[model samples]
Structures are given as C-alpha cells and as structure tokens.
Target: MTNDLLGRHRAVLPDWLALYYEEPLELTHGEGRHVWDAQGNRYLDFFGGILTTMTAHALPEVTKAVSEQAGRIIHSSTLYLNRPMVELAERIAQLSGIPDARVFFTTSGTEANDTALLLATAYRRSNTILAMRNSYHGRSFSAVGITGNSGWSPTSLSPLQTLYVHGGVRTRGPFASLSDEAYIAACVEDLRDLLGHTRAPAALIAEPVQGVGGFTAPPDGLYAAFREVLHERGILWIADEVQTGWGRTGEHFWGWQAHGRNGPPDIMTFAKGIGNGMSIGGVVARSEIMNCLDSNSISTFGGTQITMAAGLANLNYLLEHDLQGNARRVGGLLIERLRAVAAQVPAVREVRGRGLMIGIEITKPGTDEADPRTAAAVLEAAREGGLLIGKGGGHNTSSLRVAPPLSLNVAEAEEGAAILENALRSVR
Candidate 1:
C-alpha cells in the first residue's frame, strides 16, 4: 500500500520534493510524540514534521479550535474583518520584540520571506541583499536568490542581487580555526569589505541557527556585532526565524535574542510551527518598515479564520505549558547523551545546536570530509529501530537533524536518543 502511494506521489509531485529512507512509511495518525504508519508500525517522531508540530501531534487544544472554527467559517477573505486573524496578529505583535510592530500573515515561510524582501527593498530602495553563506530561506524566486545553499537553490537567475555573507556556520570555513571572538571579528571585517565593493544593500537576512545547514550557528553575540555594522550603514537586519522562533532554542525565546544585545532585528519572518501544523506564516516589523509598500496588498488565504484559530490555540498552549522551559531541560539531556554516543563513533564528525534543534554532522572516518552515505545509512537504521528523524546540510546533505516538538518529555528524548545511538553504531 505504501509503495503504491509512493508511486502515485512521484507521478504527480515535483521531482524536487524528496522523501526520506530507502522505503517511506505512510504515517496515518499521531498522538503526543508517537505516530502510527498505515501498516500498523509505530515510531517516535523526533523531527516533528520538519519542526512544524511545535506542541504535539493531534494536540487536543489545536484540534478543538480547528473544529470549532470550521463550524463557523474556514475563511472570509481580507475584504472583511476577521476577529480570529486580528486576535492572532495582536498576540504575535505583542510577543514580537520589535517596537510598534505590525503583522502580515502568509501561507508558508517562503511567502513570509518573500513579503519581507518586498518590504525591505521598498523601504531601503535597494535591491542588493546580504545573506549567510549556508542559509536556506525559501523556494520562491526572491527567497532562492538570497539562499546561499546550493542544494536547495536551483537557479542563478533572480529578481534581487544577493550577496552571500559569512558567520552563519561556526565550522568548516576560512575562519573556522579562529576563536569565538576572533571569528566574529573576521566575519564582520569580511562584511565591511564586501559592503565597500557593492551597491547599498537593503538588508542582511539570516537564520539565527542555519537549519538546513546542519543546525550550525556562530558565537552568541555574532549577530550583535553584525547589527552594529549594518545599523551604522542603514542596512536593515532581517531574522529568518522560521525554524528558530517561539523558544525552540531553550535559552532564548527567539534565536536572534542570543545576539540581541543591540536589540531586536528590524524585521522578522516566521512560519513552520506557529500554527502547530496549520498553514500559518507571517512577518513582523516596525510600522515604518511594514507599511512602506505604496500599493494595497492582501494574502487571499494568508490569515484564514481556521488557521488563525489554530495559531491562537497553539501559541496559547505553548506558552501556558511553558514548553520552552521543557525544551531546555529535556533537550539538554538529549544532546549530552548524543555527544557521548558520537564520541565512540568516528563517522560522527560534530554534534551541535541548542534547545530541541540539534544536528549530528557525519563525516568520513579519520577525515573532515562530509559523508552523506553514512548519514543516509544512519537515517535508515534509525527508522528500522522505530524512530523518525531528518537529514540536512550544505550541498552534501551529510548531517542528521533532530528537532522534536518543544513539548517532548525526558522519557521520549531518552528513547529517541537510544534509537539514534544504535543507528549511529550500526552505520559505524
């Protein structure tokens, strides 16, 4: 049955939409941290649908909200006032650190980022953008242009002239050998040099932690340093928090807070998890930047009533349950356990990330070269052991990504860690 469905999926879907494992399982239902396949096999879900299920699978609160809202209305275009949309927007605006903030919703992170690009270019009157070296933004033309990862980006032709910047990844680059402070200095100097040779850029967009780049991140204050330089030159700082927002990082509610000594970013784009599986994406910026567009704009399905209902319920549950605190405590133990396991496995090149977002970089034994083959083996092994995980990296796709729901408990973390350890061992 799974094979038949896979055949149909491949026949109609874009070839670029990749699936995991040698044979993919058809997940039919989920509860808490566990999901059941069509064939009756159960597995612990660690990647949380690419980290979109922020709270839990089949969360009662979100489920109830969706059902209740659907009974009333699924959508009532932007032409009419939407109570749920306004309420969700208000909640997000208050939560967002940007002052005098305004919110505009989209259907996906890609659209959220695309909206951000429109605002930045209009506000700053420049088409040049600074993006991180190993970052993945979205699949849209503008987002793809700013995306520096070769694996995800397909075309060189773009609407915007993007300038790739350094400092997103702390390892595997010319400045990898430098100390934390020195690395920041070197990256900032590089940015300054790049600025001198280019047209005035509208903004520098970056992920607090490079999600598709193996969850890699630079020193805590690196962005603060970059903010200083960009602020002096009037270049806006845009934080792509699609994967790093809403306290997923444990220590910080927003990933940018780690380097927020200067203050919040000028604009922020978010999706994937805010609605807890519902299609909800948005951009938050100070009124000046958000309102820069001269013509009126609206997303036909951006802030639909049903999705807003889901977003409100999910956000409330996440905060009321203090999932961020849970993420810190449990994710701490999980990382330590994986680090211990990785120490015994030579193919495990490095273990990195914070909170529930972690990455295990696989490499050839006795060398620093990326080993995507070993990574694929570990992924398959983990699935065989009844655990669902994810894989990502730069062009090589050689890192194991582990981003479970923020509500994940200690027992689940330990169980997933054990399965992952055995998987890594099997591959080794």
Candidate 2:
C-alpha cells in the first residue's frame, strides 16, 4: 500500500517536494504528541509537521474553534469585515512590540516575507537587499532571491539585487575561531565595509536562528550590533521570524528579543506555528512603513475567517498555558539529555539550538566534514524505532532537526531521546 501511494505521489507531485523515510508512512491521525500511520504503527512526533503543530496534534481547542467557525463561515474573503481576523490581528499587533503597528495577513511565510520586501523597497526606494549567509527565508521568487543557501535556491533571476551578509552562523565560517565579542565586531566591520562598496540597500533581512541552514545562530547581541549600523545608514532591519517566533526560543518570546537592546525591527514577518496546523502568515510593521504602499492591495485568501479563528484559538491556548515557559524548562532539559546522548556518538558533530528547536550535526568521525549518510541512517533508524524527527542543513541536509511541539512534556522528551540514542547507536 505504501509503495503504491509513493508511486502515485511521485507521478503527480513535483520532484522538489521531498518525503521522509525509505518507505514513507502515511500518517492518518494524531493525538497529543503521537501520530498513527495507515498501518496503525504509532510514533512519537518530534518534528510537529516541521514545527507547524505548535500546541499539539489534534488539539481540541483548535479543532473546536475551526469546526465552530466553519459551521458559520469558513471564509468571507478580505472584502468583508472579518471579526476573527481583526481580533487576531489586534492581539498580534500588541504582542509584536512594533509601535503603532499594523498587521496584514498572508497564507504562508513566503507570502509574508514577499509582502515585507514590497514594503521595505517601497519605503526606502531601493532594490538591494542584505540577507544573511546560509539563511533560508522561503521558496517564492523574491524570497529565493534573498536566500543565501545555494542548495535551496533554484534561480539567480530576481527583481531585487540581494547581497549576502556574514554572521548568521557562528561556527564553520571565516570568523568561527574568534571569541564571541571579537566575532561580533568582525561581522559589524564587515557590514560597514559592505555598505561602503554598494548602493544604499533598503533593508538587512535575517533570521535570528537560521532554520533550513540548520539551527545555527550568532551571539545573542549580534543583531543588536548590526542594527546600530543599519539604523545609522537608514537601512531598515527586518526579522524573518517564521521559525523563531511565538516563544519557540524559551528565553525570548520573539527571536529578535534576544537582541532586545536594539529595540524592535522596522518590520517582522511570521507564518509557521501561528495557526497551529492551519495556514496563517502575516507581516507586522509600524503604520508608517505598512501604509507606504499607496496602491490598494488585498489577499484573496490571506485573512480568511477559518484560519483566523484557528490562529486566535491557538494563540490563546499558547499564552494561557504559558507554553513559552514550558518550552524554556522542557527544551532546556531536552537539549541537555540529547547532548549526553550525542557525546557517545562519534558521528554527532554538534548539538545546538534554544528552546524546542534543536539541531544535531552529523559529521565524519573526528573530522569537520558533514556526514549526510550517517544523518540519513539515523533518521531511518529512529523511524523504525517509532520516533519521527527531521533532517536539514546547507551541507546536504546533514543535521537532525529535533523540534517537537511546545507542549512537549518531560516523559515524552525522555522517550524521544532514548529512541534517538538507540537510533544513533544502531547507525554507528
């Protein structure tokens, strides 16, 4: 049955859409942190559908909200006044930390970021964009243009001239050997030098933690330092928080807050996890920047009623349960446990991330070169042991991505870790 489905999927779907496992399991249902395949084999879900299931699988609150809203109306478009959309927008605006903030909804992180590019270029009247090295923003043409990871970006043709910046990844770079303080200074100096050689760019867009380039991040205040230089040059700073927003990083509600000394960004784009599993994405900016577009615009399916309702419910549940704090406490423990497990495995190069978003980089034993084959072996072994994780990185997807739902408990974390440890050992 799985083989038949795989054949049909390959026939109908784009080749670029990658699936996991040698024989991918058809997940038919989920409950809490567990999901069951079509063959009724259950596994502990650590990837959370690429971290989109922020709260939990089959969350009752989100399900109820969606069903109730659907019974009344699923979508009324952005043409009519959407109460749910307005409510969700208001809540997000207050939490956004942008003064006099306005929110415009989209359906995916790609769309939100594309809208952000539109705003920044129009506001600053420049087509040049500064993007971080080894960062993954989205898959759209404009988003791909800004993306620095060569493996993920399929094209060089772009409307905007994008210049890749340094300091997104602290390890495996020219400045990797430097101390944290020295590294920040070197990156700042590099930014200043780049600015001198190029036309005034509209904005410097970056992820606080590079998601698809692996869960790598700069020092806490690196962005703050860069913000000072960009601010002086009238270059807007846009934080792409698609993977780092909504308290996923235990210590900060938003990833940019790790650099809070710099104040809020000129604009912020978000998408994944906001609606739990529902499609919800948007851009938040000060009214001045958001209103810069004189021409009228509307997203046909951006702020539809159903997705907004889901967002509202999910956000409420996340806040009410204090999932951020949970992520901090639980994620900290999970990382430590995984670190202990990784220490025993020679192929495990490094384990890095904050809160629930963690990455284990697999490498050749006692060497720095990435070992993607080992990573793939571990992924398959974990699945066979009833654990589901993810793999990503710029180095041919050599990192195991262990981002569970924010509601992950200690027992589940320990269980998942044990399975992962066994998988690593088996692979070795």
Candidate 3:
C-alpha cells in the first residue's frame, strides 16, 4: 500500500518535493506529540512537520475552532471585514512589539516575506536586499532571491538584487573562534565594509535561527549590533519569524528579542505554528512602512475566516498553557541529554539550539567535514526506533533537526532523547 501511494505521489507531485527516509512512512493521524503511520506504528514526533505543528497534533482548541469556523464559512475573501481575522490581527499586532503595528495576512511564510519585501523596497525606494549566509526564507521568487542557502536557492535571476551577509552561523566561519563580543564586532565591521561596496539596501532580512540551515544561529545580540549599523544607514530590519516566533525558542516570544537591544524589527513575518497546522501567515510593520504603497494591494485568499479562527485558538492555547515555558524547561533537559550522549559519539560534531529548536550536526569522526551520509543513517535509525525527526544544514543537509511541539513535556523529551541517542550511536 505504501509503495502504491509512493508511486502515485511521484507521478503527480514535483520531483523536488522530497520525502523523508528510504521507505517513507505514511502518517495517517496524530495526537499531541505522537503520530501513527499507516502500518499502525506510533512514533514520537520531534520535527513537528518542520516545526509547523507547533502546539501539538490534534490540539482541541485549534481543531474545534477550525471545525466550527468551517461550518460557518471557511473563506470570506479579504473584501469583507473578517471578525476572526481582525481579532487575530489585533492580538498579533500587540504581540509584535512594533509600535503602531498593522498586520497583513498571507497563506504562508513565503507570501508574508514577499509582502514584506514589497513594502520595504517601495518604502526605501531600493531594490537591493541584505540577507544572511545560509538563510532559507521561502520558495517564492522574491523569497528565493533573498535566500542565501545554495541547496534551497534554485535560481539567481531575481527582481531584487540580494547581497548575502555573514554571522548567521556561529560554528564554522572565519570568525567562529572569536569570543561572542569579538565575533559580533567582526561581523559588524564586515557589514560596514559590504555596505560601502553596494547600493543602499532596503532591508536586512534574517531568521533568528536558520531553520533549514541546520538550526544555526550567531551569538545573541549579533543582530542588535547589525541593527545599529542598518538603522544608521536607513536600512530596515525584517525578522523572518516563521519558525522562531511564538516562544518556540523558549527564551523569547519572538526570535528577534534575542537581539532586541536596539528594539524590534521594522517588519516582522510569521506563519508556521500560529494556526497549529492550518494555513496562516502574516506580516506586521509600523504603519509608515505597512502603508507605504501608493496603490492598493490585497491577498485575495489571505486571512480567511477559518484559518484566522484556528490561529486565534492556537495562540490562546499556547499562551494559556505557557508552552514557551514548557519548551524552555523540556528543551533544556533534552539538549543536555543529547550533549552527554553526543560526547561519546565521534560522529556527532555539535548539538546546538534553544528551546524546542535543537540541532545535532553530524560530521566525520576527526574533522570538521560534514558527513551527510551519517546524518541520513541516524535519521533512518531514529525512525526505525519509533521516532520521527528532521535533518537540515548548509553542508549537504548533514545536521539532524529536532523541533517537537512547544508543549513537549519532560517525559516526552527524555523518551525522544533516548531514541535519538541510540540512533546516533548506531550511525557511528
């Protein structure tokens, strides 16, 4: 049955739409942090559908909201005043920390980032964009242009001229060995030099944690340092919070807060987790930036009633349950366990990240060279051990990604860690 479905999927879906594992398991249903495959096998879900199933699978509030809203009306184009949409927008606006914030909804993070680019370029009257090295924004044309990861970026032709910057990854770079303050200074100096060589950029777009880039991040306060430079140059800061928003990092509600010494970003984009699997994305910016366009613009299908309802319910549940606190507590234990186990595994190069967004980088036993084959083997082993995790990195996708729902508990964290430890050892 799985083979037949695989054949059908390949025949219909794009070739680039990759699947996990050599024998892709068909996940039919899920509840909380666990999912059941078509074969009735239950696995502890750590990846959370690339960190999209934020709160949990089959969360009651989100499920009920989606069901109730669907019965009333699934979609009412942005033409009319959507109560759910308006309410959700108000909540997000207040949460965003951007003064006089206005929200515009899109169906995915790609669209949200695209909308942000449009606003920034129009407002600054510049087509140049500054993006971090090893960053992955989205798959759309504009988002692709700003994406600095070669594996994810398929084309170079773009409407906006993008200049890749440094300091996103902290472990493997020219400044990797420097102290945190020194690294920040070096990157800032590099940015100042880069700015001298290029046209004034409209914005510097970045992910607080590089999701597809193996969950890599620079020292805290790195972006704040960059923000000072960009601000002086009149370049806007756009924080891509698709994966890092809503306290997934455990430390802050938004990723940018890790670098918020200067303040919040000029424009902030978000999507995954807000709707707990429902399609919902949005951008928040100051009124001056959001309302810069002279002509009209509207997302015909954005902010649909049902998606907004789901988002509101999900957000409420996340807040009321204090999932951020849960992530911090559970994630701390998980990472510590993984690190202890990794110390005994030669193939495990590093274990890094905050909150629920953890990554284990696989590499050769005695060198810095990435061993993607070992990473893949560990991933396959984890699945065999009844655990579902994800993999990503700049060096041929060699890092194991473990981002469970924000509501992950200490018991589940320990369970997942044990399985992952065995998987890592098996690969070595």
Model 3 is weakest, by summed lDDT over 10 consecutive residues, at 295-304
**Tens digits of lDDT, candidate 2, 1-428:** 88899999999999999889888889999999999999999999999888899889999999999999999999877988999999999999999999999999999999999999999999999999999998998999999999999988999999999998899988888999999999999999999999999999999999999898889999999999999999998999999999999999999999999987979999999998999989999999999999999998888999999999999999999999999999999999999999998899999989999999999999999998989989999999999999999988888889999889999999999999999999999988
Deviation from native of the Cα of residue 61 in model 2, angstroms: 0.7
lDDT for predicted candidate 2 compared with the true structure: 0.94
Over all chains combined, what TM-score does candidate 2 have? 0.99
Count residue pairs with overlapping backbones in model 1. 0
Query: Model 1's lDDT to the true fold?
Result: 0.94
Clashes of 3: 0
The list of candidate 2 runs beyond 4 A from truth reads none
Off by over 4 Å in 1: none
User: What does candidate 1 score on TM?
Assistant: 0.99
